[model samples]
Target: MFIIIPQTPQNYALRIKQHAERTANLDIRSGVNYRGLAGFLNRPFAEDHRDATVDVTNPAEPPLVCVKSLVEGGRQTARSYHAVSDCATFEQDPPSLVNKAAHLVWLQGYPAPEWINAIGAQYRVDPEFFRRHLIFLQSKDNHDFAAMPSSAQRMLTLRLTTICHTQFALRQTAIEAARNEATNAVRQHQQRLRTGDSVVRKYSVFDNTIFTIDQELAIYVERKKQHNGWIAIVCSDLGKDLTQGPGGLSSPWLGEEPASPPACEPVIMHVPKLALKHPHQHRFVNVTSNGSPLMYQNASLLADTIDLQSGGDDIYLDVREALHDVFTLIAAAESQFLTMVQGLVDREIQLQSSGKQTEWTLSNLRYFKSSIDDHIVNLENTLDFLRHPDVPKWAPHTRSPRALSREGTPAGQAQHSRYRSPQGEAFAEYSRLSSLGDDYTRLLQRATKLSNRCVENTTILMNMAMLEESKKAIVQADGLTRLTLLAFFFLPLSLTTSFFGMNFRELGTGSMHMWVFFVVAVPFLLFSTLLCFWGAVLPNFRGRMQWAWKMFTSGAR
Candidate 1:
């Protein structure tokens, strides 16, 4: 299974003879088994069976899983049986996307470097270049990989198991192809959403958001807009944390391996990550759009139920990270609403009046309130996705002193040799995210208060409008009253004058005396009516008439 080559040309005859004998015994004509080899390597996320019950609880051992291995032998194609009986896929690459295609397939399961080199030769770059140089540039600033555990190796097999079991080789350009499709769709949609006259980097607000990240710098952001031409920009920031070694430059062994580059950081190597439970070593993989999350988990390697049930500080780091990422997103949404609120408040204050529906209205507040309720529920659901699982089967556990002692273990003593995960530095970062979630909840409350204040302002403005209408109504009523009184006072005198002028033989004769009475009486009545209204109604009528004149002249429309 191994060879030790000496760096010498000193024994050519003897070495040639030995090589010939070994080659004769072995079938040199046999081809390499790439498919079975790939399938065997598929189990990246394996359970070490560190838990004893997995094997014992099995009713019976499963039959050997076999796949045909097809390899190239010189000019001919050849085949072989690659049995997955107690396959050591997990044993091969463990955590890194090593066996699978990641930066460089430098791990155990990949075909020999010479084979990969042969393929690379067609593309004018050696497979050795990655093993030699490029990989060193990746994963520099992340302590995240360093702080994880062997159980985390489950991450690797997530995608591999799917790719192999579903029986498809990892596409050489899967990311590239999917990326072009997704980017084009998103870019087109963005173009549709943007107005041709839109400006950038200004104090404007929006109802939706698009986010982007500078991959190389690791500068992730939820941007307000999808800046034009940004799709063409490839963010090629490999992490700086790589090549600095797992312990970093501060390690005492700086004097070691001086020839080659510094040791690589412990990469959180995986093509996907989701979660579930399994026996032996079941693996899974997920692929997502750029800046989206993927899941990889091996469920069979978890702690006991007692520890997992303990809430609060005892959750897994992956769970914590998920929670943090979600809350951060929710907070971004709230921030958008808050920004709109700020602009509206400024406009209202300037106008000294509640703006109309098309400008700024109560509906904005109402929509904001409804959104808050919906999102809080969603936030709870997000947490539930992490919690609602057979988590005890894969996640690490940490029990408090009392819980540990319930099994009668002493304070400083160990408990059942179970996997007790520590609250490592990684967990601390996740905790910050959790705290940020709380902050967003508080921000939501503040927004609710502001919403209330806006409602109150609208109410006050409405009342003032009612008062102005009431004052106009009073003035119009006074004018109508004066006109009614004048008509009523003249009624009897006008009737008498009409009777005298009838000129009927039985009714009466026309008379100059009647005319004299009518003229005198009408004048007296008019004078009395005028005196009655003169002081009391004049001011109101003049003011109302002036208002009507102003309305007619100014063309209020």
Candidate 2:
């Protein structure tokens, strides 16, 4: 039954205290304290009323908490699809009416802490498992958490928790939208200033770019706050060897008998909001429209022919089959993220080469570096989860017939002992999960490569800026050289004129002729002019002079 708090003050206090006490009772030896569990329980659920005008399929829309299950339609009849708003539906349905063979429950979005607590209690699962599992999934870092005992190793149960790295264009789209909006605002401000408006006087290219990039950075951070949690499946053991019975019970989720036991009845799969099928992924929904709602789109129909042929002993085959679409969506999202980053990088490269790099380009490059770094963290985390030690084995194991025959004889036993049995998919999904790991590693490498490129581009931009500054300094020095040359040329002419016009006895008696002044000043002027020309052209003159002398000697010869 669901925990419903009454509207009375005393009742609210009682409920809060009860929830807190329940969370506190959870084993803290794992160092997980059910953090924020009480907070989610205390807060009222935000209801989203349906409206025809609302776009349910929009990636930006809030996700709903959907609980999907299977119920019987008739005696010896195929199970019918049933969906409800709460976990209580599982308990409310009669055991006879529900499918006891496999209890399949799918939750689309993150439920309240109370709901998770209730689910854990109902399934008799370790509350610490959910806590630790969530801690790994939601944290952005790739560090290790406090080690917890595996289900099989501790409680003789089956459990699997995996983090899938899914992507969406919400960040890219929102950041770009913010940039355009900022640019338009800046342009308008500039237009106002150009019209001599006093209100828009203090603005520069630097200001414009900083504003735009700051807006983008804010959007980037906002996007980072959104996270898609992990996928968890918990099954209970019947406390007996499955092989002992003639008609062995198998979970409807997996393949044949070799498959591991499925989680407890009414298997609970917490599919994060981030893993919901995109609008384009739905078969009957309008892809052109916004999107469909969070209506258990991730649930598997268990329609695999392999399962049917094997009597559904291997539930993981269906589990893997169900996740195929999720994986595909994740791939698409990753592609989008990479494409966005690459486009920015290409744009920067073009700008840097063409001498058109601006403050915006530089700041944007810094932001790109940060985004790539964040992406690398996510990739590493996903890789770490895939490589977890507690995961179920992938391949099946069967003894060789030769080894079996040898088991009866000493020599045969020796040979059988040496024979390696083929590994099987007992309880885990190895090959598919490993394949995912490889893909994530590849993505991580790509992200790292882009980060390096961003740094390189940033360095080159700084060097080019410095080069432009040096060119300006050289131009100023050239102007100073020209002024010095003019001063040198006028110096001798001024000196000669002054000497002749001085109040000396010879000059008073006209002993100093005007011709003398001209004679002395003209040669001095010519010499000064030559000196100035040498200062300006000596390097070029030396090379030209060598070439001319060579030409004249060749002609004489």
Candidate 3:
């Protein structure tokens, strides 16, 4: 029985406070948490009910609703519940709160920050009880009860099942988004590599190849074009709710990190998990499925795929169709990259007259190598998603349709099996996706190999060019040294002949004394010798002298 309460938090808190006070006075907690009409624990849906007035200003807190039912083995009374007059309905004895009876208190939202304070203001409860129940709550949601056997004892199992499905849906969504982004990133890199070749063209030996489009503008372009990610909608089951999961999410619950993790941090020393954060952030880009984010994601962005595949469509089909679209985009982007690489490689082959690698070509090759690596990552992600363990775990296994004909079998069991009943048809798609992933991997591998080979060729060509240039430099320096030596050899004779050719008739030979010859010849001879010693001789002698000095010093030491 649904007992709707006012949305205001205070209304719920009031009843909880009253229950605590009464339970304390009586010195015994109730078997069922909520009271019965004038007699025992009330079964509300089986009796009186009312609709709640909702107020949503406070995001941190939502109205709490209590679900009270008979405990296992508790005797059923003929009296019906009065939702408002539970105390009046019970004449002599009131219901016990936490004894032999089964008690389920579904906190509609997360444990409100004020819950403890509100409950504690009047009465105190065990801190451990709150801590344990909250985690049990973490694993619960509305879907579990949406399809279930109504035994509250099986709440934990139902909750865990919800989380498992949640985890997979999240994983599938995140993988698709990430891989698609990776493939597109590679495609974008290729475009820059090809169009940015104009940078290489801007250079000749004169232009110095020092600056290119890639070096100056590519970084800015990438930063500008990069899509900084954001979340648009929360994907969760918000239509209805239950007690089995972390509180039944009446409101959409995506990724809300508590101000703190489970309050008992010192006791349980493990890292807090952020797995939910991923899929919650990675909204489906262009399609819809069980894993798709809320329709609000495409509210102003685009039309949602959920509209086309809404009522009664198979979830697996929706998922595959979404994935197929993504893979197509991935394939197309990769093909463009391959085309660019092929063109570059063909050009490289045709230009047989290879020598030194220009700075432009070398830099471009380095960037292209990064694209090859990106493609490899994209391919691996594709495989990882296709073969995810959850896919098989969630599939209906090899049971024949006849095996599922039992009338009482739940719909979830029938739909979830991979090979069982009608679900084999759905699981068959997993094999196809895996095969597709393999095909794409081969394509990526081929591209990477081609890129690797081209890079190796460029490296070899650059090394050879450097070696040849070094040899030319050495030979030119040697020729310069030889010419200097020959000039010195004829230097004194040339000076003497020039002196004879001079018109020195005005100055008599008498004025030119024997001392003059000594001065002129000796100075010229000394200058010539000094020039030859410092320029040619010292060049060859320095290395030998250094070696000999080092040897002598070592021997002395």
Candidate 4:
């Protein structure tokens, strides 16, 4: 039997009708004629054509059909629908298979949510199906979440929340597996180093490219933008010309042939944008990674990557990879922080423009502040993790030999002593080599702390810039308002002055009395002008002028 689905006021019935016509080739309205069931399905109903349709089928049961029809000329209509079979048949069809394989589910008026949920639930039958379906759901959910209405956003959020709950458990398992692998690799590396065998190994943890110790040079370049005036002066001094060319030849046999112009090669000095404050040097430690000695520098800014031999062996670990992971975390935190800041800025702009005297409680600002605090804490924790002793014991040590010489009387005695106790010197050397691991561990901790601080400081600087920009915008708005007010107050005075100063010769013939009258009027005019200027204009103008001056000077400095 045919059933009519009423249109909800919020629903886009017209849009649905248009979609059906375009996609399903089902004309909801055919000219002006009103068609019943056949025309509604095949063509369109002229009376109430705006509605949705869906075709449903079950492999285990007979096929069914349902359609939604709008109430005639009414925005609020009873949600009526037509069904070929009983409601039980439509409900019991296990919408999953139809949703998963159907080419045109929309044509039958099956809501997308019902189908998606059905398909997702059905994935439990097969393990691979579950994984693929979850991935699909995640992709679809993310896309839809971005475009969904606020109400729909909640649904999208629920979907993602479920996915996250499921995925996180799996992620934990994966992480545990990875940790085991890393631990095993580290142990193998330590064995090789203990045997004092030379080995070259590639590290997964550290970067290959070593940054040069030119951080001072980098800082100089970076700071130049902030010190524009100082930079200008330095540039001018360096750019001075030091050249004298021969003057044009004089007459009188061309001054016995003008002296030949001195030909000299122009001295070209490459002046760096800024000079390095100090020289930095580093040596490569022969802790091999991938068939090469791993090198690291002490300078935090200068060191782009470092290799640490793992498990006390020649297996070098890439510090860059670890740093990359840290950087990724930082970036995610930064994005969330930025989003919160943007939301605050938007609200602030709206509030200020609306001229509300009440202070705005910017929820986003608080959210952002909280987020940043958490991020900083996380960074500190991560830094602690990096400084853990286990992470750095991967690189092997390079051994060096030193010569011991004894003097004169000692030379005679040294021959006897050397033969008597070569064992003592060897013992001392062994002790020093054994302590090298402890020393390296301490050095790694120091380096890791410095790097973490650099990242933290950079983030702080970015946030400060945002804060300054917001303040600047507010100040600009206030200045504009003050300027506008000042202009308004002066407008009447300007009009008065203009009116009296006009010719207006037709008012009176030339007379001495007119001149006397004018003389008398001038003082009154001056008095009135002074009264208005001092009483109303001067204080406000002075205040605004002072504010502007201060803003400009402060900004310039």
Q: Say which candidate scores most in lDDT.
A: 2
TM-score of each: 0.31, 0.44, 0.33, 0.18
- Candidate 1 Cα deviation (angstroms), residue 167: 48
Report the candidate with higher lDDT, 1 versus 3: 3
Candidate 4 lDDT over 100-151, as tens digits, reads 0111111111112222222223221211221221222221222321221322
In the range 334-445, model 2's lDDT, one tens digit per residue, is: 5456655687689879987887876667777887787668667656655554444233221123222432454688865554444322342222233344456567678778
* TM-score of candidate 4 versus the correct structure, residues matched by position: 0.18
The better-scoring model by TM-score among 2 and 3 is 2
TM-score ranking of the models: 2, 3, 1, 4
lDDT values of the candidates?
Answer: 0.31, 0.39, 0.34, 0.27
What lDDT, from 0 to 1, does candidate 1 have? 0.31
Between prediction 1 and prediction 3, the one with superior TM-score is: 3
lDDT measured at residue 365 in model 3 versus the true structure, 0 to 100: 52
> Cα deviation in Å at residue 241, candidate 3?
40
Q: How large is the C-alpha RMSD of every model relative to the true structure?
A: 26.2, 18.3, 22.5, 33.3
lDDT of 3: 0.34
Tens-digit lDDT track of model 1 for 273-391? 42343423322122222322211111100110011112233332123321233234334444544555556554554564543433333333343344344434444433332332223
Give the backbone clash total of model 1: 22
Could you say which candidate leads in TM-score?
2
What lDDT score goes with residue 177 in model 1?
40
